[model samples]
Target: MPATTVLRPRSRTLIIAATVPLALAALLADDVRVRRQLDAVPPDPTSSRTDSTTLVPASS
Candidate 1:
């Protein structure tokens, strides 16, 4: 008769310990990539500056 092997609690703990760091690294890498992409984009100068042409003159 073949003996069945059971998973120990220590093995489960080891698996969790290994996976958590890898998951955190993947999340941090994605965040850095998104930040770099956002940084590469140029800001809209027209939107930031208020032009006199945009102001309406009040009639007395």
Candidate 2:
């Protein structure tokens, strides 16, 4: 079993092979998160709720 085999520090190949899926899954999850964030709509600058922290850019 990879669970027990991965715990053995002596077998470097087994450890690397077993952990490959975990690494790929992490990468895929991060990619999906970034794509979703990129597709998200930007906030409206003309909203009436005057928050000073949200500054509008000048054309100057």
Candidate 3:
């Protein structure tokens, strides 16, 4: 069986440096898309209330 190759700290650093910016940019772009979608949506007047308080009598 081959031993797991231990990555050097510099390689780890390079990977982190490569990926963090891409992740951050993706997050920011997704936020912008979500904001646009939210803006496009109209407010629903009935969404704040629920019918959970309505109850039926228990059967004898």
lDDT of 2 by residue, 1-60 (tens): 555554556677788888999999999999999878865846558876465356787798
Model 2 scores a TM of 0.49
- For model 2, the local distance difference test gives 0.76
Q: Residue 9's C-alpha lDDT in candidate 1?
A: 93
Pick the lDDT winner. Answer: 3
CA lDDT, every model vs. true structure: 0.80, 0.76, 0.81
Report the C-alpha lDDT of model 3 over 1-60, residue by residue, as the tens digit. 357987789999999999999999999999999888876776667765344344666799
Best by TM-score: 3
Clashes of 2: 0
lDDT score, candidate 1: 0.80
List the lowest-lDDT window of 10 residues for candidate 1: 48-57
Which TM-score value belongs to model 3? 0.63
Residue pairs whose backbone atoms clash in candidate 2: none
Which run of 10 residues does model 3 get worst, by summed lDDT?
Answer: 47-56
